[model samples]
Target chain A: MMDSLAAVLYLILFPGFVFLLVFGLFCEWVDRKVYARLQNRVGPPLFQPFADLIKLLGKEDIIPKNVDSILFQYTPLIAFAAVMTPIIFIPIWSATALFPLQGDLIIALYLLSIPALALFVIGWSSVSLYPLLGGFRAATMLFGYEVPFILACLSCGIIAGSWRISDITAYLEMYPASMLIVIPGFVIALLALEAKLERTPFDIPQAETEIVGGVLTEYSGKKLAVMRLMDDIRMVVGSSLIAAVFLGGFIVSYGSISWAGTDLTNVINFLLYIAKSLMIVFLLAVIRTLFARIRIDQMLDFSWKYLAMGGIFQLFIAVMYIGILHG
Target chain B: MDLLKWARMKSPWICHFNTGGCNACDIEVVAVLTPRFDVERFGVLLKGSPRHADVLVVTGPVTQQSEARLKRVYEQMAEPKFVLAVGVCTCSGGVFHGCYNARGGVDTVIPVDVYIGGCPPRPSEIIDGVVHVLNKIAGGGLAEKSSVNEGQAVQ
Candidate 1:
């Protein structure tokens, strides 16, 4: 059991968790910088994420006597680890992943959802009724966002003619339009991610006004730190997947800083991937900074009526592409 | 480090109360959570309980019924708390002061730490006032600045 646990730990945390931390830090750096620029204010240093993790780790963890101690203690850890599982399988350079399993993407997506569900549970199990209300709101938000999200992803999968991500990537080269065919669908998908990942505008459930830090009111110390870290990584992994699926990995390469012909576009493609993901992640953050939360009813209306309309248009465009290909 | 520390010192946990003003100020206050002015980045959090809060932000003039609830919430808060009398109503009951129920601004009942002096001060300005109030709290100077009507102060 120990060895099996160790093996699972190696696959989940060793490379996966470490990579997520580094990527999260980088994405946060870009996000803060862009947000500052957007508002014409100087932002924090690029190493701010590193500083925050250190600071939060050092702060005393405050526990509310009123809280359900068991759920309160474990939820953040579950969330921290759960979101990292998806990153291990996302290809940064090629179709190769360290732990490429059958239906890994599907598992990753579902497991990726667990952390948030745990958050909802944490809120429910807590003593305060306010957090319970926030938890209900979070569950409501999950329902509203997932409809558009599932539609967007399914449309892309249908267009690519594969559910397996690696197979989908393999088919990319066979078509001239390639990842661009999924671009419109990817946009709506990114917005759903913005909500699911609990970024701004869609952050009503956790709105400080209604729920008083929403789900995190009772959390403190290393637990809160871990949860914060988890949030950062979700942004990274979600954006990275969007980039990998729609932005084409490894678009360019260079020769040790000296001029040379590029046979391997993988390095450049990696650069493109990073750049694209960073841009999307920062844009999402900007949207959060710029807008206020809409009423949940309004958001629901958007999901079913407006955002879904956009997703259908994207699906229409994608099917049109496939039709053109075979026709 | 000291200057930065001083800057940090000026930041306080603000608790807002809406007495009887038009909810415009209350709405603007809540709007801070929107991405535009993330008060969390400044370490100025919106704590849930009065016990945890250091700054008491009161918007609207004190109305007869709400004035009592306001005082109760205010009394429940631990000491070293600064009150922000926001809007014209909170300042002097504004346009509503003549009404028999209007008790002028929060100052009419509680000694306001800072008067934010706008019908609805911009969110950034409210942030500024709250930050200034934090300095006052950190200095440990919130004494018996109670109003003349502490006994008859609404409640």
Candidate 2:
């Protein structure tokens, strides 16, 4: 009964959350397409990521003779499930989410963190020197990116006057201009998330060529497949969270779905959430094509120096916003 | 066009070996995959292990220290593999050609099929050279036309 209830709520939070479950392929497709065009070369058809996933899945699971069987098998699911948990707490539209409990911002923030912990576990449990280094890099990255991300979230909370996501939307409704004011804050938050996502210009922790897919090097077959999908869903969830928090979550009531005079506002909200998430995913992919991965020092310097500076300045702006509005 | 289509579909997987050159070419080789110049669309991909590769893309001027790693990678690659010496440093060891640490031209270590002939050839030219190797594999111009050169290139 609880499982069924959760299913209905998941459907309610965003009609398109399932779409994000498949979003990694979309990001992959976008990266391939954009990169191809950048070189004046023809890019792959948009469905390339889907093709790759199927191929990877169909591959035989190969375990090295000396490997730890249990950790090797379970690591990918941990990565996927840990990342997916945050999706349940994030509101897609006004007063809507997979679980719709209040204080969701707190819940969502903590849930968003588990994937990093899981990644470290995977890296360490594999018992390889390269992944161990990659895992350490992942831990270092967590320390560098999370502070600025939390501050950016706090600035939004300051603007909205509550830790609740629903309240953030309501504050935006009361003063739609609050959306415009949070621009710098939103950008810093997005970059910090990008760094966490480990896209190029910030992919120092898992340099594939140098470390052989980093923490994922020994992961193969079903395990590797799940981990890859987790990455895709992570992008989806991250993008959706950004939209819910800053881009007017579920504010648009696109033609309603009604049953017996009760409007399924939840369903409408879901579509809105998906649309917003896809836009962010597309922008990320397009940006990915144009940039190369930066060195480790450069990545750390970028987050600590520019991205962090932007977050601090934006926090200052948020303070001035409260002064002007309430004072 | 038929020949080009076949060449495109069977684009050989490239294995990169650093023979002790500075990391500039190494970075450019990787830059080939960034959103700007995706080589994967052409069916060219990098293989981490040499055993699975069809072509060996050698960078650097073949320093004595790196020579052992390079030779190991070359020996691991399957038969009929093409050797592409990228950058002037690999072909004729540019500035570092005369350095005591430099072995001068990758050919001093392994037989080179095509020399890309640039400080660092544009990714497009790298693609060109890579595709050229595929052509030779399929019995194209150089394979059909050049000397069945038997001299050990290292000498």
Candidate 3:
């Protein structure tokens, strides 16, 4: 009973709700700062995201007359919960996750996809024109990206010889040199993940310039705040998943650097994990800032043509390499 | 309550609404968002949806066709919203005053919190106007007026 209680507390406090929320907002600030510097403009202060959240929360929650009240009001919370669930299974400070399971990688993938599904539901339930269009676009983008994203993950699983994320991390720790071979698949997956997060170049679903806030057009007040926070958390989840799979999941014991003793390794590893994920988030922001939003057809064509083909090629290479080595 | 007010003041997302005049004031409003002026430094984002906006930066004199839309947009915004009427046209219809189909100014449609007057106000003036609105939000300028309006409506 004590163990279960402790697990619940850990899930809600340390590596779970509070930690992810704060770290996610920190990552958002870093992204905004880098984006502003890239554009040669003075950006928001460090607490800008937090301030925005507070203001949104303080605003009056408005529900339009044409909408399904129940679904429209509840989906943001569902989306936020969906994104938060995966953080528990991701090994942040150590090889073993707080809620480790044998096939949690597949579970994490499904959980990660829930936010997009929830978004579709939110848009559909609104019964508004822009949101309906945004819902259709989000669904189409999902179809375009999910195939390549899965193939990329499958390639990593094949190379590491395990579907369990903890096992993959262990294998990578044993053979750190294999990260070079995994880079191609990682790059393909990273681009797909960026589209999944709905950033620029692939932000067809929420093209604010054309669709007028897209799926989020009808959301206001606390719902909007929750949605924005969910997006930020999703960014952290995507980056952390990529970092765990490809960058050797929180193994901060670099050669000959024994400055910290064993007791402090957990804290150091946690910071290292956050740093690695922030680096990925920064790269994503730089890519987003450098590119303009692409048309839906152009986005579909690029994803289906280049990214899908690249993912398959990477998968094929991984299969051949693994078969030869095992045989 | 104080923290909420501070947060609202710190990050004021503005939604630009053009009623019916020439495109000059609209262009200037967009210029404030450009890299040169970059109102984002003050945490000002040009929100696409009225639902997400905290401040409505209105341009142009109200036309008969757009007057209702302007009111609807203002009503759609969340509470604690402020309206900044930009350009002389939005303030008092400018040269379009007394023209057929002109509704004079934004205040004829919805209450305005700040007035920025120029044929087409420069981006700097627009920025100053936004800062003034931020002050009003922080210093309770609108609070007193809203209370008075509430009392009058009750009577």
- Find the candidate with the highest TM-score and give its number: 3
The candidate with the higher DockQ, 2 or 3, is: 3
Candidate 3, position A272, lDDT = 79
| Per-candidate clashes, comma-separated | 9, 6, 0
How good is model 3 by TM-score? 0.96
User: Which ten-residue region of model 2 chain B has the weakest summed lDDT?
Assistant: B145-154
lDDT string, candidate 1, A72-96, tens digits: 8888878777777776666665555
Tens digit of per-residue lDDT, candidate 2, span B1-155: 44433532354557788887787788878777665776676556676645445578888887778888887777655544678888999888788856877776877777789888887777788878877776675564434423323242333
Q: Candidate 3 has which clashing residue pairs, if any?
A: none
Q: What is the C-alpha lDDT of each candidate?
A: 0.69, 0.71, 0.87
In the range A125-190, model 3's lDDT, one tens digit per residue, is 999999989998998899889888888887888888988877777777777887888888888988
TM-score of chain A of 1: 0.86
Off by over 4 Å in 2: A1-18, A93-95, A253-271, B1-39, B42-44, B47-155
Give the number of the best model, judged by lDDT.
Answer: 3
lDDT of 1 at A38: 78
DockQ of all candidate complexes = 0.10, 0.10, 0.82
Q: Which is better, 1 or 3, measured by DockQ?
A: 3
Candidate 1 stretches with Cα past 4 Å from truth are A1-15, A173-176, A249-267, A316-320, B1-155
